[model samples]
Target: MRVIKLTIYEIIFIIVCITINLFKNGMGLERLLLPLIIIILFGNLFCKSNLEIKKNREFIYAFILVFFLYMSIQGYYDYTNVSKNNYSLFKALLIQLPITMTVFAAYIFGIKIKNFNWRISLTSLLLVLLVWLSIEILPIIRYVRLNSITDLIKLIIINIPIKIYYPSLVEEVIFRGLCFSGLLAIGLSEDKSNIIQAIVFGLIHILNYEQFSINIILLIVPQIYIGYLIGKIYINTKSLTPCIILHALLDSI
Candidate 1:
């Protein structure tokens, strides 16, 4: 039975991330207390577990039931939305729900999906931040100057959660958690698994574009590198926490 542990830096980093987001959303001290308390309690419920439960018939059945329910809901939404010509970014996010549910199912079933370590989380975040600053900051600065502060803040606030939950959480759970791990489980070498998942991750982005073109190729090339970097992080750390947080930050900005 392995215990999930956090270092002081990791704990502080998590609290700071939550606090800044709350403050940005206009949560003052008086109103903040309750939400913060609730968040802490909710987080504890997930993090306090020893993750030692043995697999059994009941767990397997429950996993299948929940996974099917998630897929059904997602399928229904896609069918309804696409038929009405009302497919939105929000609706598109539903595509990720099945993968997200699969990750949750693994957690609930006491499968050791990944390790969460403080050093890995912190290092990953910092490295990604540096890369983002170098490559993405200029474009963001130009955009910021053209928009009102309030509008920019509103945009960030609205998009942060979507970015976090969608491409960040969902993609990592799929490529890194499922694809990478699944390959390793089948006795593939780590290098081979990492490369395969990264390529698949990049190839999947083709669905984002309407049709294949040179432009799509140009866009996907970067995504491949990004996927590779993220996959490498997962291989080294065996954790998705840093990948999700850093990927969300990149998309949000």
Candidate 2:
């Protein structure tokens, strides 16, 4: 077998992505081991070669540039919010505008965006509904309590745009557009790239819990599955639109 060489940017890109997820919440030695171990195992499984990396150096550079720019803006927003204890629409816009522009540019450049296909779109939508009903609906029903129809409507109205733009659009762009497509562009097989991105997607949710435990680790399993499904949708449709819509609908619930 031929040896696969990774470019420096490729290594930095991978490290930055992992580091962002691992340390995003806070540094805790005890909380780090399990997720770190899992990440290592997944990395070994998926990132066994870098021939693709060498061939796709320009794409790697572009991906790194875009990812870092997004993170920098996001870091600024987070810093200002924490320091000032003020959450203003302007502050939020500072972050969202860059993300919106990045996603738009990504689509315009065809980085995971494809020509519209109604059959695939419809199938993707059906899959999204099935996922919501089977995996998400029960928990939502159990946990979400609303006072009245007006309140429900208000919540939906307020959350739909936020959920769609931020998490759905931002995450789909990063994981599907950058990570998954970047891997594929660099020569990884579709299966390996999908699993790796999905694992990273799931692992990042570790930050969502205040405290770590085996149970908290277990909860991320569903996220991995969801990420895998989203990756599959992107692969099938050759587009981010379905993936973004699916993610938005899921989060909106």
Candidate 3:
């Protein structure tokens, strides 16, 4: 029952995402199938959730707090930037608020930092690194050929803020923390929660890249697998710390 509700909610969430994307792209209703891949994955993996959100008031409040905090920061950034060049702060909020709120919701729901197992975490990190690198080997080689070691170092140094927020902290918290944890709390098994949330995580990247092409299509599988890896680490350690490190490193590389 609870699981059924969550599944329905997930489906509705996907629809909302698709609708938002269509509006953003100025596309028609017919192209909705492109994003339905996410729904398909969820439907195939659907299971009844026994966990209840009503019991999770603390999590909800935390999510709200984080969401507003992020929005405020982004609003400030937009205001400062736009003041310099007549930019539209409202437009920035319109574009980013949904995604930002979603990620923060996941962070509040999924992140539990009590148990820390360095051994298990390091092992998970290594495994995720291998998987990420293997899938990205071609790109890695191309990057190496294009940039000297110092250049790579400089790039990492310059993009530290970006790598931490976008790929590492925010992504991991949303996927592994909110999606995975919320599923678990709602009575889904660990494995089912991981796979379903992973698929959604991969699908959310559609918005991140702001393109709905075959490249994004090709990315779902790897992203799903990567999401599973991160969820697994979170499950083992009962913490988001390890997953955040692994996700950040994967994105940075």
Candidate lDDT scores, in order, read: 0.55, 0.57, 0.51
lDDT of 2 at 123: 49
Residue-level lDDT of model 2, residues 1-253, one tens digit each, is: 2232344543554454345435553423332333333333332222212222222323444555566566566556555554245667566665587766654444434443332222334544555555444445544554455355566557667877877778787777677767776787778877678778887778767656656787676667657656866675565456666677778766765
On the 0 to 100 scale, the lDDT of residue 32 in model 3 is 40
Listed per candidate, the RMSD to the true structure in angstroms reads 13.6, 10.7, 10.8
**Predicted candidate 3 versus true structure: per-residue lDDT over 72-107, tens digit per residue:** 555555455643365464554454444454554434
TM-score winner among the candidates? 2
Go through the candidates in order and give the clash count of each.
Answer: 0, 1, 5
Question: Once model 2 is optimally superposed onto the true structure by TM-score, how far is the C-alpha of residue 111 displaced, in angstroms?
Answer: 6.2
Task: Supply the TM-score for candidate 1.
Answer: 0.55
Enumerate residue pairs that collide in model 3. Answer: 3-49, 51-186, 51-187, 106-178, 110-177
Which of candidates 2 and 3 reaches a greater lDDT?
2
lDDT of 1 by residue, 1-253 (tens): 2333344543453355336535443333433233223323332223313232122333334334444554455455445555236667765566665545655565655544443222344444555455445445555667789986687668878887888877677567656666666666566666666666676777766656657886665556556545755665454445577667667766886
User: What pairs collide in candidate 2?
Assistant: 52-186
Model 1, residue pairs in steric clash? none
Q: What is the TM-score of each candidate against the true structure?
A: 0.55, 0.59, 0.51
Order the numbered candidates by lDDT, best leading. Answer: 2, 1, 3
Locate the minimum summed-lDDT window of 10 residues in model 2.
46-55
